[model samples]
Target chain A: MKKLWISLTYLVFIVLLIIPLIRIFSGSWAEGWEGFVEALTRPQSLHALWMTTIIVVSVTLLNTIFGVMLALYLVRATWLGKRLKQLLNSLVDLPFAVSPVIGGLMIVLILGPNTIMGVFFEDIGFKVVYALPGMILATLFVTFPLMVREVMPVLQEIGTQQEEAASTLGAYSWYTFWKVTWPSIRWGVIYGVVLTVARSMGEFGAVLVVSGNIMNKTQTATTLVYQDVENFNVLAANSVALVLAAVSVGLLLLMEWAKKRKGH
Target chain B: MHIEVSNLNKHFGDFHAVRDVSFTIEKGRLIGLLGPSGGGKTSILRMLAGLESPTSGDIVFHGKKVNELPPQERGIGFVFQNYALFKHMTVYDNIAFGLKVKKQSKDQIRERVMSLVELTGLKGFEHRYPHQLSGGQRQRVAFARALAPEPQLLLLDEPFAAIDAKIRHELRTWLKDMIERLGITSIFVTHDQDEAIEVADEIMIINKGRLEQKGSPWDIYKNPQTQFVASFIGESTIVEDVSKLKGFEDASVWPGTKALIRPEYIEVGKRSEFRIASATEPGRVKHIHFRGSEWMVEVTVGDTTLITYRSLEKEVLQPGDEVSVLVHRAYLFNDNDSWIMENKLKEDPMPIHI
Candidate 1:
């Protein structure tokens, strides 16, 4: 019975993931690669790719640095600040709790053109609600948890022993941070960065409200897929979804490779 | 290297883990930081190594105060109990870590590491991970890594306690010889009195975060400075209200007192001198076992237990038999039950091995 259950589970898994991917793959070529080629070569598609690359890189880098510092702060801080740190730790996961559409609405309410905060932001010469800036903000908001969640657990497991040991060994704080602390968390950081990149790449609803879907400025692949689907362009939509799927697979492979390297 | 520790105190929150620990070590002696778990022996060692800061006091090494100096600059070698070898590195790289940290040249690091590998009998096992080696070999690798820094002082915390019995026995002798060859001042911490005696030139027995006694191994074993040390070091029988014997110094004796005497000093045979009143009340011998060279006889003396080791050639004293025990070599303590003093060697007591 146990064996039968395991076999049935594997069957279900294959039917769900592999079968759908096969359908997408078949549909992808049914249009003779013309849809994929057209999608890739079009100005809108290139702009979307450019926007995604810029947003993912910026969000991932900023999130990783801030997240690492947050983890280090929470673990090392003492006294009253530790309690505040504990509260902040739980608060960092707030993005996961809210619905993506609610997340979009929240960003719109706070940063849209009609709000006082939005007016102030615009007066400061930063266009947050309907531009590349808002897209980056939404991407950063949804994906900020990845890097901290990754590096924090590794830091907790390794404990402060090696850091203390290095300090006593005469490595100054920065040297110790770079050599000992960083090396131990390097694989986890990379894994987290890959997760952030993937998450930022596929971010849609929140970004959609803020990006205004500018054709050559702020439409990401996820938003492109959504817009193309709405327009009843099934081939273009399927091709964009296929590209997103391919990116997810590539990032997932990177994660697995990181895990293997960590094991070594 | 000479080390002077003054009023070193360490606390973890409300707990006074190490309190006012002060000791001085003459150069080139193997000192044992002897204590049970949680006695803060490791904490003191860490403070000396600059791994942990003392809440108070200072450690002076070679006439330079190093309480604030970082561990890497302390010029002290540390061997962790579980042998904290770098799992990612082979034996060769593990030993060479300190040198690499110091930015030594490649050839120099190789030569130093290889020589240590040879010295530690790890010549053929240089490429093995710490997990791949035997426990004893892993311990040796830890020692080799420690020595690679060419440290003036070395520290080992329960270094042999993790190995299997046979391996422990083998490594203890080899390690002692190796340390002696290096002639580096060292301190080894262990709970087992036997291990401390085997390796330490001087032993400091600690209890309840306080130093119970500190002396040469023979001195501490022969005449422990405290009842705790006496009981901890050797198997002994404590009898109180014996009505203080005439000549012994029971330091706090007003009318009567107790005595701490080891089992080996007691002779169980027909001695015409003293009356063996409690011992002769015939109870069944109950259990008799040959202990390789001698017979371990458990004779009940009234409501108490007395252990006696008799010769193998003697007629087996079985259960339900009569026996006599004569207490001779004894270390008497005061009424408050703390250690006062110990008897001197009138004559080298026979088979007086502790």
Candidate 2:
């Protein structure tokens, strides 16, 4: 009975994962290596890839800093009242609850060029909507919870005893955090960063809505793939997706390594 | 450094953890905050270490008020329960953390850390992480780490609670000797009565967030001022209506009082062996426990059960056997105060004959 169940699971996994991955890998090289190179070297394709890299780097950095800070505040800040902490804690999972498309729409509505804050920013000579900033913001919205969720449990697990021990040893708060707290949570932060990077790389609905899928100005890798699919350019879309899938697989491996280190 | 705390109170929301606790410690004295769990002994220790602020009180060290001072400025060494060693850093780095934070030169840090490592008996294990070391080794590293910065005082919260029984006993003696040799005023919190009595120069008993008593172990054992102290300080059984027991008939004058009988105060022996057999009450052995070095025999005289320890040199006692039990002393206490009551038969060992 157990063998039958195990075989059933393997069948489902191969059908759902291995088959699709193989199809994409073969589809990307339908025109051979020269055609694949040609598809990826187009100015629009290169720009989209570059934009994705910029978004991934910016989002990962911002998310790591802010997410870790928020997790620490939620777990360690005694000044926050119980109700307020609970409210803020639930608010952290908002990105996971709301659809990314709706998240992008909310940002556009709140910070679009016609809005008061948007016009004020434009008056100061900074473009937000349908630009690099908006694309980054959209990806940030979808990936914010990934880092926080990964780091929050780690912060909670380490507790405040070591920090207290450090303080009583004549170390200041900042020194205690860097010496005692940072080393303990670094693995968790690394895991969070990997998740955030992967999420930002593959973010599609939000970035498309916010970036307006501009060919060179703000189009990201996933958005360019969407545009190609919409225009019946299956080969181009497959080529870009193959790159995303490869990076995601690498991040998965990195995440597993981080998880093992954190177990120690 | 001499330390004084006055009217210290701590409240976690509506729950009062420490209430009106006041005490003073002389310089170089090793004090023990001894109490049951959740009795606020740790709260008092943390407040002294500046880890927790008192709700309303003043902590004065060397005649300087430090209620507003942070733990870093207070210059205290705190050893947490379970050691709380830095798992990531090697033993050497863990000990050098405070020195590095104080901006000591690398040479000075190395010099201090090496000496501490030697003092703590962790000489060869400097490069191992906390997880790689045993519980006792980790505790020593915590001690060395705390001592590296040369703090004015030291605080340990349940220092031996995480170690095994044998190691705990060894560490207790080692810690007591080390603290005395260094002449560093230290305070440790422990729920184990044996640990506190055996190691502390003075033990402060805490109960229900209040300071019950503070004295030398022997002094507290001989003279317990409060009912709580009388019952808490040793292995005792609280017996009501003490006047019902033989030789305690005069105790009836203190109505509504309870008597605490410690095992050492009661002697159980064979009827033929006791010289004062007339004064000794006949009791039935209800249960016998084989302690490592002694036999703990429980005897029931009339309706009351009394506990007494018997020597292994004497004839073995068995359950359901008839024996003569003579209680030399028992502490009688009411709600507010306590006093010792001696067996009146002891005054007249030989009875008058007609």
Candidate 3:
């Protein structure tokens, strides 16, 4: 009975996953290579894709490093900063709880020429609002928690024993970190980075608020998709949405693969 | 290779984990730092290895102050209770890690690791990760790793705790041979008195962040200085009436005192010689546990059940024999025993770590 139930579950999973890919494959069948070529060569469409890739890659790299550092700091540090660390750790879900538009607005309010950061940056001939930096800030805010969430528990569970053992064995702190500590957390960090990339790719609301949706440079894939729909270009919007979906599905699958390899 | 821990202290928030623990260990000695759980054995080892800082004192290794040094800078190898092997690395890499960190020549590292692995009976298992090894095998790997570095001092934090009972004795004997062969000053932390007796040159019984006694294992076993040491090191039947021993003038015997006796030392004799209130019964023997040399006999002493092990060569008492047990070489400790007062531990001996 248990075997029968397991087989049935797998059968259902295959159907659920394969059905969508089949629809996607079948949907693009009529359009073929000509549509694919057109989608790739079109300047506005292709440039938007390039911008999206850049935003996702840059924002994700920044978030992964900072997130891991934050996790290490929170776990290892003993000071008056602990209460603050707890508050910051819980701040990961701030994006999920608050609307993305509000997060964007808060950045604008705090650093948009009228606020102290904005006023200070203005004096230095820099701007956060209506700029690429602003877009990064939005993505960073949304994705900050991903890597930390992945890495912290692994660090906690695997613990300082191996690291301390390494240290006592004559490896300096940094050597112990890379040699003993990093291997255990590397998979978790990769999963986090992959998630951050996917989330940044489809990040729309806050980037829309901050980017001002500049047609060629600042507009990201999700923002461009929104722009296309608003401009009554439904097919173009569908194309970009499908691309985002494809990337997300591909990376999520990569995460699953890494997880399987680790499980073994 | 004398290692001295001077005024080493650690605090976890308001709780003082180790308080002013100080001990001097001579070279080529295997000392067991014995304590019950939460007695701060692990903390003291961590400080000695520089994994933790002494909140107030200094550690001197071979006449050099090492308190400010980080763990890696202190050429000491520590084995954790669970044997914290580098899981991602193969057994070869795990054993060679300490030497490699010191940038030993590759050939030297290989030779050292291979020899240790061979010694540990893990020769063919070099390529396997920690997960692929059994608990006993993992413990050997930990020992191999610690020994690979040729440390002046080796610290083992309850290395045999994770093994199954059947393997514990065998593994412990193997460890004793290895540590003895190395001739490195070593301190092992354990709460089990049997393990300490089997392996250590000296045993220091700790209770509530204080050392109760530091002496040869035999000194501790035969003449436990404190009640805390007596109970923690071995199973003892302590009678509060020890101060009322036949001799009253001895300074060793004090008022409100107790006599702690290990059951094995108690010899059964006739009713005429029995001092404590006693009773005898005739009933079918329910059970006996076979301990290689002796058989632990369980019999009814009236309403209460008592256990006493006699030589296996001695005639096995039949199901319905009336027998008497005698108390010999019982330890006397000052009584007025209260756990709260015991923890207060006034004028306690300083902790010593080698």
Q: How much does each candidate deviate from the true structure in C-alpha RMSD?
A: 4.8, 2.3, 7.8
- Look at candidate 3 and give me any clashing residue pairs: B22-B351, B23-B352, B257-B335, B267-B326, B268-B324, B268-B325, B268-B326
Better of 1 and 2 by lDDT: 2
Which segments of model 2 are wrong by more than 4 Å? A1-11, B271-278, B318-321, B349-354
Residues A54-79 of candidate 1 have per-residue lDDT tens digits of 89889988998998888777776554
- Candidate 3: residue A86 lDDT (0-100): 76
Please report the candidate that would top TM-score against the real structure: 2
Best by lDDT: 2
Candidate 3 interface RMSD after superposing interface residues = 0.9
CA lDDT, every prediction? 0.78, 0.91, 0.78
TM-score, chain A, candidate 1: 0.92
**Judged by lDDT against the true structure, how good is candidate 3?**
0.78
Q: Chain A only: give the TM-score of model 3.
A: 0.85
lDDT by residue (tens digit), candidate 2, B27-129: 9999988988999999898888888899999999999999999998998899999788888889999999899988999999999999999999999999999
User: If ranked by lDDT, best first, what sequence of candidates would result?
Assistant: 2, 1, 3
Candidate 1 lDDT over B1-354, as tens digits, reads: 999988989887788888888889999899998988999998898888887789999899999999888887888888887776656568887787778788999999999999998898888999888789988888888888888878899988788878899889889889889888888999988988898898888999888778888899899988787778888897787766433322233434545556676778665554342353432223335467788999877766555566668787766777666656554556656646544333332234453467
Q: Candidate 2, B17: how far from true, in Å?
A: 0.3
Per-prediction TM-score, chain B alone: 0.87, 0.97, 0.81
Which candidate tops DockQ? Answer: 2
Question: What TM-score quantifies how close candidate 1 is to the native fold?
Answer: 0.86
